[model samples]
Structure formats: C-alpha cells, structure tokens
Target: MKKESKNIKKNKIVDQFEFDEFQKWKIEKEKERIKTHVPTIYGYARVSTEEQHLEPQIKQLKNSGAKKIYQEKWTGTTTKRPIFEKLISLLLSGDTLMVTKLDRFARNTQEALTTVEDLNKRGIKINILNMGYFDDSPNGKLMFTMFSAFAQFEHDLIVSRTQEGKAYAKKYDPHYKDGRPKKFTEEQVELAWELRKQGNTYKMINRKTGISIKTLQRRFNELKLKDSE
Candidate 1:
C-alpha cells in the first residue's frame, strides 16, 4: 500500500512539471503574437515655417492609424530637432515611423539616407504617405536611395537656378539689389518725398501713403542729403 502511494505521488509531480512547461510556452507564444500583430506606429509632421499649418499632415497621420505623433515648425536644413530626437529614442525595433512626405522626413539626401539606414538596421520600417512603405529589403532600399538622391538633386537644382537668375539680374539691371525686394517701391518712396516736401507731418504722410513715419523720415533725410551733395 505504501509503495502504491509513492508511485502516485511521483506521477503527480511529473504532471505538475509538464503543466508548468506548457504554461510557460503559452505565455511566450502570446507575447510573440502581440509582437507580430501590434507594432507601434509613430508619426512625424514638419513644416519649414511657422506660418505653414501642421493640421493637414496631422490629420492624414491620424487617419492612417498613427498611435502617436511628433510635429515641428522648423527649417528642414537644420540638424537639430529635439522633439524628433526624443521620438526616435522611444521607437522600438518593431515600430513604424510614418511621415506625410519625404521632404517632411528630411530636406536633403544625406540626412535621409543616413536616417533610413540606421532605422533599417534596427528593424524599424518607414511609411511615407506619398511614397508608400520602405523596409530593409533590397528593393525598398534601392527605391528609398533613389528617391533621396532625387530630392537632394531637386533642391540643389533650384538653388543653382536661383543663383544664376540673381547673377544675371545683377549684371543686367543697374537698380537690382542683391537681397530681398524692397517692401516699398521707388514710386512709393517718390510719393512720400513729394508729401514731405509739401510740409506734411510724417504722421499725416503715413496715414495717406500707408508708409511708416520712420521710413518716411529716413527717406526724406536721405533725399535732402543727396540734393545738398
């Protein structure tokens, strides 16, 4: 009778061990399932100037199921983005980084390529709303590289064209100033001068011509100096 009790106790212990192993396997499989199906999606939106609105990009990202978003009103040429850096640090290997467009991701080729490569190495995927998804796959890499190159080329071409146009203008046009166009035109300045000569107060001239009193006074003084010379 004691021998029979020992055999039953041994079987019970074995059964408990098997049960624990099965529970551990079940927990691991559950974790794997969640990891496969529920990747976190992060969105980024950016504009070059404060005047540009982030609403459109934000809305698009929301519609595309981004769980969180980072936004900025910063020039893309600059390398420092504190919020962006924070967001990048939080991203995990299975996460996806989504952006409204390539320009929003990066303004130049080198920045884009380097960022993408780093993310790819860490098993992070990128989703550009206008360009579709990109991963570490051979085809995805090729396409992303080509797109980045084109983006840089386009920006450079635009800058080169603008410089050429400015150079041509400077050579051909005697009155062309090499900076921002004047807010008030030469005709407007002439009108202000005429008003000043008629003994109008700077305040009165400002009300009449929409030019600021300071500007009118400065111009009138300059013109007086030129006449005396």
Candidate 2:
C-alpha cells in the first residue's frame, strides 16, 4: 500500500510537468543569449592618395551592417598604417573584418598570404566584397594562392611599365629632367649663394628665402662641380 501511494505521487508530478513547454522555454532562452553574444562587425577602407575617395567604400560597408569603420589614407606597399593597426588590435575571436577589396590592404602575394593566415589563426574572419569569404577550404586556399600570385604579377607589371616609360623619356627627350621639379629657381639659388658668401648662415638663408638646408647644399655642390669642370 505504501509503495502504491509513492507511485501515485510520482505520476501526479510527471503529468503536471509540461515537458514540451519546458523545452520551448529553454530553446528560446538559448537563442536570446546567442543573439546578445554575437561578435561585432567592422569595416576598413583605405586610399593610397588624396585623389582617391573613400566615400563609396564607406557607404557599402555601412550597408553591410558594420558597426564600426576605420578609414586610412596610405600606400598598400607599406605595412605601418596607424588606423589599420588600431583596427587589428580591436578585433577579437568571432569578429569579422571587411574590406572593399584585397589590393587596398596588401600589395604583394607574401603580404596577402601572411596576413590572411594570421587572421585565420586568430579566429578572425575576412570578407572581401569583390570576392567571397577568402575561401579558407582546401580549394579556397588554392584559389587565394592563385589570386595572390596574379595580384603580385599585376603590381610588377605596373612598376615595369612606369620604369620603361621613364627610361624612354630620358633617352628621347633632350630637355627631360629627372624626378620632381626644383622648388628653388636659378635666381633663388644665386641669391642664397650670395647671402652665404656674405657670411649669412644656412639658418639665415632659410629664414629669408624659405629654402631648406639640403637644397642649399645641393645647389652649392652643383656650382662648385661646374667651376671645377
């Protein structure tokens, strides 16, 4: 009789427990937690020079649901970007880093490969809008490798073309001068030289003519060499 009473009490509790309702509550709570804990999405935009604008890239990233965005104006050949560094430091596991394209971030294959590998190791995701998710799979890795090689090739070709054009100009153009135009004219140099000859120091000349010491030194060397010749 005592055992029968114990079984009745257990059945009563089981019948009232509502297992389906309990499971639904547990699942809903889990979904809420995941939603709250999702990683932040960040976007990065860069332009090599002031001539290139970043507004379009910024708009696209914003449309992609990026919470924070970083803007940088720097050449891709250099790795010392302050804004890029700051963005890298802020990234955490599960966070995604988005860029408009790959070339905006890296100039060569080695840099591209190394940087992607590093981000992979840190559990950070990279999204290239032009391509897809960088393709971390075996086939994806092969694709990235090929893409890197092509990017490097294109950069090398550009450099070669620029150099070839410059060389041709130098050979054919009688009045071709190298590099940028001189900031100081012949008259300015002569005035600076006269000031120097009259005991005015480089500092004094710089103050009066706004020409740098290095420029003065170069002009003086050219004049001295011409005299000797």
Candidate 3:
C-alpha cells in the first residue's frame, strides 16, 4: 500500500513538470510568432522637376530604418503618380510609411489629409520626417491637422497672388498668355499657311517645319480667308 502511494505521488509530480515545460515552450513560440508578423517600413520620395534633389530625401528615409523605398519625378498636383500608387498598394496593416516632408507626398492639403486618413483606416502608420513624430498618436494627429490647414492657406495665398499677377499682366500686356508660348514663329505660321494652300497635311508640315501638328492646325485656322460677300 505504501509503495503504491509513493509511485502515485511520483507520477503526479512528473506530469506537472511536463505540463510546465510545455507551457513555457508554447509561450516562447507565441513570442516568436508575434516577432515574425511585425510589419516593415516603406519610404517614398518625389521631386517635381529634374533639377530638384532627391538624394537628401532618400538619405533621410534610410536613416529612419526604412526597409523599402520608392521614388518618382512628377508634379505633386496630379494624383496619377505611378510610384505613389505603387506605395499605396504595397502597404499593409501595421506597416509604417515614411516621407521626408509633407510637400514631398502631396502638394495640397486635401490630398494629404485624404492619404493620411486612408492609411490610418488600414491600421498603417505614417511618419513625416520633419514633424518628428508618427501620425498614429494624438499629438501627431493634431499637428497634422494644423499643418494641413496651413498648407491650404498657403495654396490659397498662392492662387490669390497668381490672380493678382494675371490681372496686372492683362492691364499692361494685352497679349500675355498664361501657358506655353506658341511653337510656330510668325515666319513659320506664314509658311504653314502657304503649305496648307498647296494642300499639305498637318503631319507633313509638322515634320518639315519641326512644329507640332496642333500648332500647324492652329496656324491654318488663324489664316482661313473669309468667303467673298
């Protein structure tokens, strides 16, 4: 009877020890799983023109421990940017997206706010390098809101200045045009009209005169003779 009791106690102790070891192993496995599932950081950069520098933005992102980087040369006013779309597609929940500056990501407040809100909805974080904080925090949210307001204000100011300038220009230079200057010179316009009189296609005139087909057509329209009364 005594021997049986001792064997029973020993078995219970062995079972408990095995159960504790298994629990420890399970906890370690859970930690390893969490570590592996953590998301990576991605960086994005953009320059409006070829003359602008991109190296500084790239270097800043690298220093921030960005694992991936996407870049493009395009104006910020358009939402049809290739790399920007690519970055959006690559983001996943818990991922961090970093940019060197606000204007680097978007030229206007509405676009910037929309982008940030979209990322937030996906459980992704956005880090603006100059702001010195991640966008997921309360303070960061306030700061972003303020900054966006300022950006909108600045855009409004720019528009106002542009309108004032255009008004002044119109008063002074009646022929001032807002966009690209006409490609066809006065001589080219005359030649285009002469070619059109000889039945030359706009394409042929474009190839011959190095003027765009649209410009050639416009020149032809400008020289169309009125029908005799």
lDDT of 3 by residue, 1-229 (tens): 9999999999999999999999999989867765776698999999988889889999989998998899999975666898889889767788988988877767776788778888988888988888755465688668887887787788789889999999899889989988768655788788777887898988888878888887776656666643232
* Tens-place lDDT digits, model 2, residues 80-193: 889988898767779899988878667778888888888888888888888768746688678878888987898889999999989999999999888888988999999999
**C-alpha positional error of residue 87 in candidate 1 after TM-score superposition, expressed in Å:** 1.3
| Model 3, runs deviating above 4 Å | 1-40, 43-86, 107-111, 199-203, 221-229
lDDT of 1 by residue, 46-116 (tens): 88888899999999999998999999888876878888888887677889999988988887777888888
Best by lDDT: 1
lDDT values, one for every candidate? 0.88, 0.86, 0.82
Off by over 4 Å in 1: 1-38, 182-229
Relative to the true structure, candidate 3 reaches a TM of: 0.59
The true-versus-predicted C-alpha distance at residue 102 of model 1, in Å, is: 1.1
C-alpha root-mean-square deviation, candidate 1: 17.5
Q: Model 3: which residue pairs collide?
A: none
